[model samples]
Target: MLLLTAVACLLNTVVAAGGLQSCLHTRLSPASTLVSPSSAEYPNATVSNNLSWQYFASAVVFVGSAEDAAIAVKCAAASKIPVTPRGGRHSYASFGSGGRNGSFVVDVTRLQSFSYDPKTTYATVGAGFRLGNLALALDAHGRATPHGTCTFVGIGGHATCGGYGLTSRLWGLLVDQIVRVTAVTAAGDVVEASPSKHSDLLWAISGAAPSFAVVLSFTIRTYPQPASTSYFDFDFGNFSDTPSLAVKALLAFQSFAATSAPPELGTQFTVGRSAGGTLGLRLSGVYYGVETAIPTVIQPLLDAIPFSPISNTSKLQGYMASVAFLGGDDPVNTTGRVESPNTAYEKSIIVPTSAPLSEETWTKFVEFAFNTPVPPGISSYYWQIDAFGGSYRGKRTAMAAFPSDANAFGGRDGLLLMQHGTYSDTSGSYPAGGHAFANSFAGTITETVRTEGKKIEAYQCYVDPLLSADEAHALYFGHEKTHKLKALKHKWDPARVFDYPHAF
Candidate 1:
């Protein structure tokens, strides 16, 4: 009779276990719809910018509101399952969807909503609003906020990660424009962060966003549209034979940017392999003043070059039109091309004004661009150098909202940001060798910068997946600030619930 009772008790335990599994697999919150792997929405929810890092989630919580997001976090905590919040899904390192083995992804793209207060000159923006839609909305009000060039990138990631755009020099980083942010904490509490409230989280989210909390919305200070804007494009064809002249011209431009270029001017220099395997350099930017001022600012760069540019074009247009023009899109309407999913690897570094540009480093960069073997469907790899010292220069010390001492962004002290990128088509599987070569080339460039140019820091937004947590912390936050970030992290998320590659 005892043996019979033991068997019956064992059966009852199994039945209870199965019932608990059924309950856990179903909806966890009234505000969120939990979609299992069997649901068709699972595929779309798991998509990321880089196909190489695509992952399947155990379940996706389609959060309808910030309250729903809070509930979802609580559910994940109860189940002891990891959770990641996804916005536009544009993380090159796949921080949004990758590396979360069987984790729950809270899709916040459904929370896109915005409101502008004309009197206060502040716009309350939903975290899920894409840059293009936000741009249009602000343009309707004759106001604008500084943002990144890519249109499809979500405001949450961009602003939190230190957004930069054509007007960033004149204004400030997207984070600088933010007056307030609302986020859901790891403790499953909805909190508002700003200079006055939950201030530590506010400082951390300004740059190291993914490591802190799930941002729900931001209140950003907006500026009135510029009266007139002008743009100039200069193309310097194959510099293989006359590389010296190109170098001289580049240095001259850099000098002008550091010493002469006004806050209203923004410039980007690109060096890459053009069609037919020829090396080329292109300089492009916009001036916030009238068309007449273009000559005064750009003439010094023109004079430095020994040879004339193959093409030079300048035009006057509205602020939004200039944005479209700079993005290589239609000027009448400020809409950028929707970037399709493709394989890409990027490395970015901050070049301080003190770092001297050596001939060896320049030659090495040129040779790598020309000699790197492109894959079957790949077109070309490129480098972009953006000027940063302008009105932004003062914000490093003057901005009280995000005190310079506590801010996590590492590029504020640099004169320019140099980005190296490798591109591959999405039509076929990404070649393993191609990615390897790109990483090698990027490492070579970084080493050269450190050994020759004496610049050891890198931009945090261009997150590299291969970096060790320690190395990434130093690169992104510097030694002093990294310690502060760690203390804050321990205070808010002691369990390290929100994590990814290079996360704080």
Candidate 2:
């Protein structure tokens, strides 16, 4: 407790210096105390409630107060140790774990405060703001940001690492809409970065931002959202046998992508676990305007899926209602401040060369994701495959410090696919074997894609740092672009204090 108090004192000084003294003080928990793994509550408090063992053993604990987060960086700099900014602890890999050896970690859960500028149509969100809380706040104001599908995703990492959501088609990637970000550099100096201000730093923070620096807060542009949004789900049961059906439906979805999509209309494909080892496909959409148009514009999709004459609801429900339908109840606990463990998993965010869902590639995906168990728990999930291109193309708008490609951002049309293996153990704990299983699963799937001679663009957030520099480079924006990013990292983080694996 004495150590906790001392740390809190130092934290107050650091955050105060950064012009956040009052805000930080107000957000700190009245009864909260910083606990370490060495503390009695360490075991339970250090790991997320749902998934344990997703972090490494050497993580240092910072109990409470956003001030503690600032102090954590200062301590690390003085000691010449590294630190990772942690909030929500939902990252699948150990990217949030600064290093294997004990490193100072700025657990920023206590800093979860948000202030809105209704006049400016902007939201100044603290680094610790949780997605759900953000959602509630915005919904009350009849405005919203394109946050994650899961409510618990932290806005700090989500925005920094390229936050995506159903509204991406209308607004843009979460990072794309961010106007400014407050980040603590390796030197422990707080800097406000944006496209116009610190152009290069802003360019590198998103998609492939270096983690060595701690992101403090982000000010994002928000939209005058509808009073209520509606979500419609069409589930295609018995997916393995529905290849032809899948092909036809996917093609129609691609057509939707090519056609001018209404700013109010956002659509995606989700294939997930079903009864009897069968694959399930859902052509889902969220429309900001009249829920009535859902059936009309989505005719192509409805024609292909196996919707029955009488059983089909072809329904439209409210935004909050849709949240329940999408399994928003799978609570993402924001209470714990510990980091997620360093475990391996098979993951990829690939944008294919084309928008059409090729039958051949779909078949290959099915086989790789289900038939092969190289990494036992790997599963295939796609958010916006065919429909991604229509909304996210051809406009160079102001974005935050996160980088965006002119072609990829709004100039060209494309889709983002997140294929991954979820780590789960029979014993209810992710053991060492679980890590090995995930790695093998990822390798086997990627090899198959290579063998098929298909080239796909990769999203850097889900990538593991273990891949070779060349491999990682190619997986990112390719060798040439990767080189530029590496050079930028060196230029910005000369001392490499914010170092993390594969952080180009």
Candidate 3:
């Protein structure tokens, strides 16, 4: 709430209101929630997760339906201002605000319509619903979908941008479950995209939708409720105290995940220091079967770390309960804050099989993580490493978006995805070397992996704010996919009407 107020003060700068209001009034419903810079809701409309990206949008439109979204797009195009569809407003670089000032913001929070068809077992939901709300809706019918832990992240961006959840290894990504979608193209025309229809558009949208289209709703293929899980966790004491021991021990865990780990197992290890200055490691996961298997499943990791765990925790719970726990929230409270303002910079490392770290590189990575000199004003930092690509990479089927080729999610081959970052003490005050600190850590791993004679990549969801547009395009999509996206971009948005910073 304080950050929201601070953001309001920072963005209260008055700017000229270009003729977007008149154009929108002609097409949008009279009762539509539209706010310009002069409106009281302007501050609320402009707030976001990452305070580092505080660009002012020319106008914010809380669209009602697909038709209304199209109208907003038409207005932005007519006014010659870039239009960006903001779902959760969680874009690390704030591309949701067009990533620049004076852009038109199409706020999708009002399109909260949802319906589940038990006959097809498919759920049709508007893009506005947050992840928690969508989860509750699905759980009502004894059904669920694979998605990330963040309760407040919007379904629109999360689904399209390769969503990974704790059960992703068993099921698949949110994009993998997308049977079809309704979207507004750059030309202000609405269309549907699925495997069987407008597939190229579907492929272009699934990985990087903002570049080509503004999605209105998604019709997803749903799965039945999964079996209860045995939650397993072991905490290794302070990292700075025993870096060589803990880091080396953790490598064995990664080895097991890449090879012998079962599809029913999912895990992530977080490396961060506590407020008491205790740099520690917490390796936690859930086994989606009997509790008996949990011991055998985690024995290798336990053996690797010779020292006794400072704390060990294991519990059996339903899927939703596990979700709330993993997200650091209580069982009853699922829908978290829609906007969480913070000063942070994150960089991702997508470890492909072709470029896995060797023993030598792994040791070097440990050295860097433990001994590297952090830049100034870096109040706190951490890294989250998730085991990816069990069923995620291997699962292939006739289901619409199941096959690797069905959509544009490019990191299928990655064995592990590491999202690491540093944050500032104050809400909007960025640390002096936040980007450099984050980049150096990610860069060390990336360079070391490349030196081992293979390829390494990054996850687009944890966007790097410092990279150039070209660098981001190459890192996220590589040459071939970037070429494909650009071709589609030209076809659908030749005028670049819906352009934003680092969109493609």
Candidate 4:
């Protein structure tokens, strides 16, 4: 039949390309679909958000189920080829695409399925489901889960790697909401990890998942839709002209967030080039309450700013509509949620409240950002500082399955999470133009923060491929936690089947 012929052709192609006939015949399942490097689907499967990462996998397996995933792993292990799981293909460093040549990649987007229980308020989600689709599904049931703003990101990767979002302060992180996880181990066994069963596995995957297993699904806690949601957008003018004022305003906001901001309020401060070519600062956020409460919570920061905002907009709407407003999308159709791939580099650092943002540091940031040359329409850059440590403080005790103190994530106790990013289009005249600028900007920021304060740390979720092995280990997981994760890796994936850059 046609299926049989296609399988025959695929087997021949694999043998010709990878030269793993014995392992393929012994371990690969007939139902598992393999896309050879010469196939047209290969390009699509290999495309990633960060185009800078050039991944050349021996084969890309379109896994249809958890069993298929296990088969792919077994085949890769038997063949002595490294294997990595790919969901949304959005890893900043292409960690999802095997991360090295001659490796095998298992793409799990075909495993999309989810169910929500109204009585128990728990949602079981497939690993391959994107955040946007999940949001639409949850909205139909009048429920919501704390997830990142980018709807196209896969939950499998995001949830396991510390899912930070607008409502993080109100409901805690997405990983913290996970009650159970189902994953395929390196030994080709499907295991369910939770608080009581596979407790250590659960703790390890809550943040450092890539080094342990290929997560297939998750059972997460959900919350009822908020009665009303409010949003505010404030443009605080160009930072180049008013460096001192901009830095003062930013520090004031951070100070307030550390001491006064309620759990229901979440804010993000950004410094980037406006559409008109001016470097400016913007403050935008959401309040999970009535419109009347927005002013009371945000007034202090607004009053602290030395200059009046150029533009201010506030609205009270439905929960979904509020999400759209925060994400700058069309409320009714969500048309703004489109994805256009490009080459980019990013780095992050966590600043604790004890080591506040100093004026000298802000001046240096302003100088570097303004001085950086961005190719007119081909490249761009930005610096973002997300408020971190409010309700997150309760995770130490609230999340019994994966306590904040012992997990691999490093930003739980930090006051602000700072991210520096530079992006360039591959089709541009100078494809690699953004690298030098991004490196300089990121290095300056990291050096400034570390020199100014001793308590600063880096976020693991923003995995920077440039980090050394020792630096990555120390930044992603501290000395003690790294050792614990390594021991768990030894027990679960002794052969190191699930490995990538910066992996445990």
Which regions in candidate 1 have their CA more than 4 angstroms from the true location? Answer: 1-31, 274-276, 327-339, 370-377, 390-403, 426-428
The candidate that achieves the highest TM-score relative to the unseen native structure: 3
Tens-digit lDDT track for model 3 on 364-466? 6667777775556667788888887633234421121256666777777777888887887778878767777677777777777776667877888888867
TM-score of every candidate relative to the true structure: 0.88, 0.77, 0.92, 0.89
Candidate 4 matches the true fold with a TM-score of: 0.89
Candidate 2 clash figure, as a count: 15
Q: Write the per-residue lDDT of candidate 4 for residues 1-504, one digit (tens) a residue.
A: 999998896675466446543455455666667886787888776767677786778878877788878877777777667778887788887888867665678887777778998888999988878887778878889999888777678888888778888777777788888889899888988899988999899889888888888888989999988999888889877657776777687778777767767777778888887324788788888888989998888898888877888889888899987666555542323223446666777788777655766777766776776676575444567778878764324332122123555455656666777887766645423345555666677666567877865655777667778787678888766677788888998998888978877776
- Candidate 3 colliding pairs: 239-279
Tell me which of candidates 1 and 2 scores higher on lDDT: 1
Cα lDDT of model 1 by residue, 101-124, tens digit: 565677777677789998899999
Runs of candidate 4 with Cα error greater than 4 angstroms are 1-31, 274-276, 327-338, 371-378, 391-402, 425-433
Best by lDDT: 3
Q: Rate the local accuracy (lDDT) of all candidates.
A: 0.73, 0.56, 0.78, 0.75
Q: Distance (Å) between predicted and true CA of 455, model 4?
A: 2.9
Model 2 C-alpha lDDT per residue in residues 192-257, reported as the tens digit of each score: 887678766666665454443667677888887665666766665555655555555555555555
In model 2, which runs have C-alpha deviations exceeding 4 angstroms?
1-34, 48-53, 57-68, 99-101, 209-212, 274-276, 304-327, 330-346, 353-358, 367-386, 391-403, 406-413, 423-454, 461-470
